[model samples]
Target: MRTTHALVQLALALMSAPQERHWGYELSKTSGVRSGAMYPRLRQMLDEGWLVDGWETSEEAGGRPARRYYRLTEDGQRELGALLRRAESDSRFGGLDLRMA
Candidate 1:
């Protein structure tokens, strides 16, 4: 992984609840990333086998259509660890002190 800031942000967001499914909009909001960019990166992560996705349906959602939810795979957890380590050591994030939560 390239370890860009956005990537780090997304990884942190997903890793926060690795065992729970998350909506894209919620991820975007939590990560401070816009949906326009978040969705594309999410798709890429799915294709790279870092994330598993599924549609969630709920009648309580005001009859809204199902929303796609994503969670990290085991491989993704390992990848996230590596990515966080890299980000912590990278010059670009030197002042950020990135750490797994």
Candidate 2:
């Protein structure tokens, strides 16, 4: 997929806690991406083998449905690093802002 500013922001956010599993809503909030954009981008990443996803399992939790969580794979980390570096040198992305919520 082509790298956009939003993609860079999301990648950075995921890399922020590379070892931790992140849920959709939390990722949306932290990455400053709306739900509409975040979900589709996440699915695209999964399809491209950049992300691994699974449902959260909690036995102690009251009967709530499991939430899907995502973690960046090794390849994802490498791809993100390259993308971020490219974006840093690209003047088009200079005006973009990534604010963590």
Model number with the top TM-score:
1
Local accuracy of candidate 1 as per-residue lDDT tens digits, 1-101: 46677788898888888888989889998788888878888888898899999887686465788888898999888898788877877888776546667
- Models 1 onward score TM values of 0.88, 0.87
Candidate 1, residue 61: lDDT: 62
Off by over 4 Å in 2: 96-101
Tell me model 1's lDDT, rounded to 2 decimals.
0.83
- Over 1-101, each residue of candidate 2 has an lDDT whose tens digit, in order, gives 88876788798789888878988888988878888777888989999898999987776234888888999899988887778778877888787553322
Best by lDDT: 1
In terms of lDDT, model 2 sits at 0.82
- Candidate 2 is scored at a TM of 0.87
Instruction: List candidate 1 segments past 4 Å from native.
Output: 60-62, 95-97
